[model samples]
Target: MPTITKSNIDYDKRNLSDKALLKLYYNMLKPRLIEEKMLILLRQGKISKWFSGIGQEAISVGVTMALKPSEYILPMHRNLGVFTTREIPLHRLFCQWQGKASGFTKGRDRSFHFGTQDYNIVGMISHLGPQLGVADGIALANLLKKNGQVTAVFTGEGGTSEGDFHEALNVASVWQLPVIFCIENNGYGLSTPTNEQYHCKHLADRGKGYGMDSFILDGNNIIETYSKVKKLAESIRKRPRPILIEFKTFRRRGHEEASGTKYVPQELMSEWEAKDPIENFRSYLFSKKILSAEIEDQYTSEIKAEIDAALDSAYAEENIIPNETIELNDVYKQFEYQDIKPNSNVKELRLIDAISEGLRQSMEKHKDLVIMGQDIAEYGGVFKITEGFVEQFGKGRVRNTPICESAIVEVGMGLSIAGMKSVVEMQFSDFVTSGFNPIVNYLAKSHYRWEQNADVVVRMPCGAGVAAGPFHSQTNEAWFTKTPGLKVVYPAFPYDAKGLLATAINDPNPVLFFEHKALYRSIRQDVPTDYFTLPFGQAALLTEGESVSIITYGAGVHWALEVLENNSDISADLIDLRTLQPLDKEAIINSVKKTGKAIILQEDSLFGGIASDISAMLMEECFEHLDAPVKRVASMETPIPFIGQLEDQYLAKGKFESALRDLLSY
Candidate 1:
C-alpha cells in the first residue's frame, strides 16, 4: 500500500563517496567472474551442480556489503554475490564445485551451498525457502550475544509462496528482529513465472501484508539496488524490525546446471539483459570518470587472476567434498542408547503421563529451555504434555503464542538458532501440514546447509486411535521421514520419552518429537525418576524372539509388544527405530538377521509411510538377511474415520498379524 522512499529511510541521509562506489563495483565484478568460472565447471561436467547468480548480483552484493562480519547472513542458494562480499575464498568456491576437501566447510558446503564460520554468518538454504526463519534465528543470536549486528536473509520471487516466508516475516515484524529480507525476484520459479502464478505484480507487495516494510527495486540496477537495500539494512540494524526489498531481476541462466531455461520468454530475457546491473554500474562509473578504461581493464584482470590463483591453490592443496565416511556421521547424535533397567522408584505409568513427566523433568533440568504452543502454557497443551509447566516455569519460559502454526515453528527455529533451546508444542500433529513449508524447507535442511544445527524440538501429539477425527488426528511423520537433515524421535514409553527428550535437547539437529495423543494419559510403564538420556539413530529390542522381527517405533512398539505377549506361537522380536533419519540400521539389520522376518509397523498409512523407507534401507543395506518379503503394518490408505469401529478396523496393521501367522506357519 505504501513504500518507504530513500529519503524516508534513516540511512538515506548517509553519504556515499566514490571510494564506496568502487568497492561495490569490485564486489559485483569479483562474484560475476567466479560465477562464470563455476558455469564453465558445471558445463564441462567438472561440478555436479551449480545455481548461478549472474544477473541478480546487485542485490546480493549490495546487501552483503552493507552488513558487517559481526552481522550474520542466512543466504539462499542464489546469493553468491553476497558470499563474495563476505570474502569467501575463491578456490574454496572452485573446490566446492569440484567437490574437493579444501572447498567451503571442507566439502560439506557443496555446490550452490557455501558457509564460513569466520564471518559470524550461519548459512542455511533448503534450496526451497524458509531461510528467513534462519535469518531471524541468527539475528536473535546476535541479540543474545549483544552484538550490534543485523541478520540479513535472502530469497527469491518464487519463495514468497512458501508458508515459512510469511512465517519468518511475521515473526520478525512482531519481535522487531534486526533482519533485512532481500528477495531476489528473478521472475520465474524454475519454469513457472511469477506473473503467471501469483496475483501480485510486485513480489514485495506480499511482505506488506505481513506488516513488514516492503519495497521493490530494479535488481539489475546496481546503484538503485545498493541505495535502497543499504538504507533498509541500516534502518533494520538500528531499530531491528523487518523490511523486505524485492529485487526484480532475471536469471541469466537456468535454475540449475541441469535446467535449460527454455521456458523464459526471449523478450523478458533480452529486456533484463539490456538493463544488466553490472553493465549499468560500470557505465555509471565510466561516465563519472571515476576510473579510466585502463583502470577498468586492470580491475577485471586482477579479479580474474585472483580467481585463477585461488582455483590453482585450492586444487593443488586439497579436495572439497566431505569424506564419504562421514555419510553416516553427523546424521545423528552419537549418544549410546542403553536399556536402563527400571528402579523401584521408576514405577509403571501410562505413556502420556510418562511423556508429560519427562517434559516437566527436562524443563526443570534445563533453565535455557522454553516451551511454547497454542494451549501449552495456560491450557497445558492439547494433550497436556505441558500441563503445570507454566505454573512451574512461569510465562517467560513456558510461553503461549497466537494460533500461527508457521509462526510457531518459525519462532522455535529462530530461538533454537539463536541460543535458546526452544520446543514448539503443536496441539495436534496433523496441523503440521500448515507449517510444513518452514519445517521441511528450512528446519529439515538447515543443519546440512549451514553445518550448524537449529536445535528446535517440535513436540506434536500425533497418531490415530483416539479417533479425534480426521482434522485433529493424523500421522504426518511420513511427510518428513525422508528428509535428511532432521531427527524424528517417536518414543513409545515414558522412559523412552524422558531419555529421548533429553537426547533431543543435547542434539545439534532439529528434532520432530511426536508424543502420540492416543497414548499420552492412557499408557503407563515404570519410568526412571533419575536422569537418563536416549541417543537417536538407534533401535531397541523390547523382546527377543526367533520367528519374526516386528520393526516399529513410538506407539507401534507398544502395539508390537502386545501382539508378541499374547501370541507366543510366533515369537516376534520388536525393534524400535528410535531415530527416523539416521535410522538404526545396525540394530535393524542385526534384529532382522537374527529373526529372518520384518513387519514394519506404524500408525501412518501403509502407502508411502516410514515403513517403506525403513524397509528399503534394510533391503539396500541388509537385504541378504531377509527370510520373506518385508511387510508393513499401518493404517488403511485413508484418513482415520470418525466412527469408533471404523477407526479400529482402519487402524489395522495387517503385517503384524499376517506376518506373525506366516512366520508361525514357517
Candidate 2:
C-alpha cells in the first residue's frame, strides 16, 4: 500500500494572515458538517442519494480557496467543499439535492452533475476524464485573451487510466496552458485499491512523462495544501503552464453512502481517522492560542443553524414535475430563419472554395472564432482547405491540434463555454466515433441539462465516392440527426455549402456540418462574395414538378438531380434538405400531398439511415395523399469498399434509378 507523506515546508514562514487561516478552517468545517447532516437526511429517506466528502474536505476546500473567483473550476461529485467554499447559495444547493426546480440544472440532474456559470464552476459529467480537456479549453481561452486566468480540474487516481487524462495533460503541457490538474489519491476508487489501479509509486510522478511540473503533498495538512496551491496558481498566472499535484489522502468513508467500506482493512481506516484534517487543524489552532473552546462552540452552533435554515428553505420549494413543453423547449436554442440571397457581387467557386471563403469571412467577422484540426495550420490540413490561413489569421486563430479528437472536441465545448466560437475539423467523418462521447453526452446535452449553450461547429469531411476505404470514407449524418439538442447540416451545392456553414458557425447550438468529400471539388456554383447565411430546417427546391417528390441531402441530392435530368418524362419535385435535425417536415408533407408519391434517398446504408425516419414521417403525416408506399433508396448495408467497382455497387446512386422507376411506375 502507498504511504501518506508530509510536506517538509514550515507553516510559520507562510505569509497567510490569521483571518485567512480562520477562513480556511471555517470553509473546511462547513462541508464536513454539511456532509454529516446530508448523511442523516439520506438515512431518513429525505434525499435520494448522497456522496460523502467527509475525510476529503481539506483537499477541496484548500484548492478552491487558493484560486481567484474569476478563474474557472471543474469539480467532481465528491468536491462539495469546492462548492461551499466558492460560496454557492446554501438554499439552492439544498434544493438541488432535494430535486427542486429552483436549483442548478432546474432539477434535471441530481448531485454535482450540473455547472453554474455564475460561480465560474463547470461541473463534471459521470465521465470524469473529459473535463480535463475542457479545462485546457478554458485555459486556452484565457491565454488567448491575455487574462492570466488559471483553471483547476479534479479527478480520482482511477481517472489516470483513461485516455482523456493522458490526452488532456499532453495538450496542456504542449500548449503551456494555465491549468492545474489535481489528483486526489484517496487510496480507493470505488473499492479498488491503488495497487490494483497502477504500479506508479505516486500518481504525480506520471506528470514528468508529459513534461509538466508535479508535486506530492500531505492532503490531510490543510495549510500545506492551501499554501502550495496558492503559490502554484500565482506562478501559473505570471507564466502560464500546466501543473499536476497528487495529494496523498484516504477516503475514510466508502465511495458513496450506499457503497460500504468492507473491502478496506479495519486498521487502515483507523489510521486515517486518527489524522482527520478538521480535528487536527482545530487542535493545532488551540495550541497556538488562535482558537478557544467558547469560540469553537459558537462556530459550531452558527454553522448548524445555517444548515438548518437552508434545509427548511429547500423543503419549502416545490419538487420538479415533468412538463413536456418546458422540457422540449430546453433542448436547443430557438433558430430564426433568414432568407440570405445572392447579389451581383458573386464568383464561380467549387464547394471546397465556397467553404474556405465562408470560413475566412466568418473568421474575419468573428474575431474570437478558432479553427482547430490536425495539420490545419502550416500544413493546411490533408484537404488543404485552410491553406494560407496561418499568414492571414495567425497561428492562434488557425491552430494545429494534436491527434487527440476526443479532447479537442471537449476543448471546443470549453471555448464555447468561455464565450468564443470554435470550429473543429474531423479530418474524416468516420473518425468522429473517437470523439463521440463529449459531442453526444456533454455538448449536445449542455443546453438541456443546464442553461449553458455549446455554440460549437464540428466540420465533418465525409462521403464514399473517392474510394478512400471504409475508415476514411463514410456518410455519418444519421448518427447525430438522431440525437436531440444537436443541429445536423448536410449541404450539397457550393452556394448551399458556403451559406449553411456560415449560418452554422453563428448558430447558438452544436451543429454537425457534413461536407461530402466527393462534392467538395466536383460541383461549382456562383456564390455570394460577401458573407451570407441560409436558413436551417428549410428545404430548397432544386426542381419543381407534380408527378412525384424526391427528397435527399448531401451526395443524394446530386444523384436525384441526375435521375431527373436523364428522365424528362418523370416530373419530380426534388427537395434538398440542408439541415436534417430541424427537418423541413412541413415542406415534405406539402410536397407529398401535391404529388401523391414520395421517395427518400441517402448516402448511408439503408438500415438505421435518415431515409428511414423521413419514410416513417411521410407515412404518418401524408398517409391519405400517397399513391403508393414511400420508398427509401440507400447504400447497401455493408462497410464501404476501397475498390472502384465494389464502391459503385455499394453506393446509393446505383439503387436510386431502380427505386425512382418503381415509384414512377406505381
Candidate 3:
C-alpha cells in the first residue's frame, strides 16, 4: 500500500464544471440551513433533540458528490448532507425531526436513525462504528456480483477509538473490499480533544497498519474533498480495495443543542468559526468567478425559503403515535423456501450431522449464500460441524473471519443488505456478547428501522452438559428472545434441528439459531434425507399426559423426556418449543389447559431466563386452566463451574423432576 502526504487541492486548477460546483455548494448549504432551523424549533420545544453538524458541510457534501448515485453510503449523524445529496426530500427530513408520520422511519426513529432502500443510504445507529463493517459487506457483495460500485461509510475522529473501527478496517483490507472509510477528524470526540484521544497526528495513518491505501486532505475545501474522493472511488471501482480518507476539520457547535459549549475554549471556537466551511466555500465560489455576489445571495435566500417551507409543512402534519402493533410490525416474515417434501429414504444421524447436512443443502440451493466464522473454513468449526465445507463450496462462500464477533455479524448485515443470504457462527455461544451490538442494533433492527430484510442466520453452539466451562457452555437465548426483530431457534432433536435451521435460513430476518453443544453428538435420530422445514412458533408434543405440562426447548426437552419415561406415575406432557422468539404460545396454552399444570424448563440461568418468560406466558394465558402455580426448572443462577460433579449438580435431573413432582402433586 502506498502512503501519500496530506495536502489541500488548488482551487485555481480544479476540474469540476461550474454547474457541478453550484450543485455542491447547494448540497452543503441546504443541510446547514436545515440544521439551523432545527435548532430554532428545538428552542421553541417543537422538536425534542438535534445533533448539529454545523461545521461539517464540506466533508458531508464533498464526499457525497464524489460517489456514484448507485453506490451505498452508511452515513453518520453529521452527514445530513449525504441525505440531501441523495435526494431525500427536505419535507421528509423535517417531518422526521418533528416526529411526523411522513418521516423516513415513519417517525419510529429520530436524528438520522433511518435508511432508505431506494437511496441505498443506511442511516446510523447511536453506535456508529459497526456500520463501517456493514459497508464492507455491501462492498463484498458488489465484488461478488462483479458490479462496478464502491461504498463510502462515514465516521468521526473520536469514533476511531472504538474496537469496531479496527475490526471493520481490518476485515475490509483483508478482503480487499471497495470501501472508503471517510473520517471527519473534527479534533474532538464530544468534549474530549484530539490530543487526549490519541498520540498519532492523523487518524488516516492507522489505515497503513491494515494495509489500506490512505490519504488526508483539507476538509473545509470542498473541491479538494470531492477531487480526492472521486479519484479514490475510480480506483476502487477498477480494483476493489479499502481506502481511508481523514478530513482535518472541527465541530463548531456543542455535541447537541442541549449540550452547552462551556467545555470548549473560546480561542479554539473563534479559530474554527473563522474557517467555517460554508463561508469559506462561499467566498471561494465568488472569488473564482464561479458565482457572482448577487447569485450567491439569491441561492442562500432560496435555500432558506426552501427549508422554511419544509419546516412549515412538517409542523402541519400529524405527529406519529408509535402504536405498539405498527412499531412491532415487520418483525418477522413467514417464509417458505421450496417445498419441504418428506423423503422415503431416512438416515440415522447425530444432531451435528443433521445441522451440517441442512447447511450443505441450503448452500447448494442458494448460490448467493455465504457462511462466515473464525474456524468455519479450514478447521470446519470447533465441533467439526462445518468440516469439509471449504473444499466443497470454496473459501469465498465459506469465509474464515478474524476473531471479531461484531464484524462477523455486521458482515452478515452488509451481505443481507446487498441481496444475499449470510450465515454467521460464533465459536462459542457465550462469546456472542462481543457481537451483541451488530446483532441487536443492526441485524435485529434493520427491518423495523428501514423495512430492510436482513436475511441472516447466526449459528450458536450452546448449553453446559459437555463441560466446556463457563465461557463455552451458556444458553443465552433469553437475550435474543427479548429482541423484537430476531428469531431464536433452539431445537432439541436432530430432525427439529435440521428442519428449524433450514427455516431460519429461509426467514427474511435475522435468526439466532442455538445448537446445544451437548446434544450435537450425544443425540442421534432418524432425519429425513431430503430438505424439510419445521414451522416457527410451533411446539412438538414429545409426550402427552393429563397431570403436568412440561414446556421446554433444546437439551431441556431431552431432560423432560427422560423424566417422563422413567417417572411413569408423574403423567406429564412434554412440549418442545423449537423457536423461542416466535414462541409456541398456542401449544403451551393448550397443553397447560389440558393438563391443568405447567412446568417451564431451560438450561439457562433460572432468574430472568427464557423459563421466566415461559412461566409468565403460562400464567397469563393458562391461569384459569392451571391447577397449581407455574413452576420453572433451570440451571443455577451462578456461572457454570469447571468441576464435572458441580456442573451436574447445577443442572441436576432431580431438580427438574422435583419441580414436575411438585406441580403434579399440586
Better of 1 and 3 by TM-score: 3
Residue pairs clashing in model 2 are: none
Please report, in order, the local distance difference test score of every candidate based on alpha carbons: 0.73, 0.90, 0.85
Residues 485-523 of candidate 2 have per-residue lDDT tens digits of 999999999998899988999898999999999998899
**Error at 309, model 2, angstroms:** 0.8
Per-residue lDDT tens digits of candidate 3, residues 1-666? 122222223364366789988888888888888888778878989889888888888888888888998999998988889998898888888888776888876766888988887888988889988888899899999988889899999999888899999999999988898999999998778888899998897888999899988999888888888888998899989988999999998888878767778888999888888777777767676666776766767878998888878878987887676578776666655455554766888999999999999999999988999999988988999888889999999998999998899988998899988999999999889999999999988888877766887899999988888777888888889998888888899889898888988888888889999999888899999999988877787889888888888888888888888877887787767888888888878888888899898888888888888888878878888889888998888888789876889899888455988777767767
Candidate 1 similarity to native, TM-score: 0.80
TM-score of every model versus the real structure:
0.80, 0.97, 0.96
Q: Model 1: per-residue lDDT, tens digit, 1-666?
A: 112122211122136788888888888988888888878876777668888787788888887777776667777777887777888777666766676766654455565555566765555555445567767656655555556677777777777777667767776776667788888777788888877767977777877687878887777766667777666767666676777888778887888868977887898788777777677677666655664677778889999899889878866874334456676565543444454443456767677776777777778777778777786778887666678888788876776666678766766776665667878877788888777777776676555554545668888788777767888878788777777677788887777887888777767567888887777777776777766777777777778878778888777877777777777776767787777766787888888888877778888888888888878877886678777877777888788888888888788543467666765565
Backbone clashes in candidate 2 total 0
Candidate 3: lDDT of 615?
Answer: 86
What candidate 3 gets wrong by more than 4 Å, as runs, is: 1-12, 333-339
Summing lDDT over every window of 10 consecutive residues in candidate 3, give the lowest-scoring window. Answer: 1-10
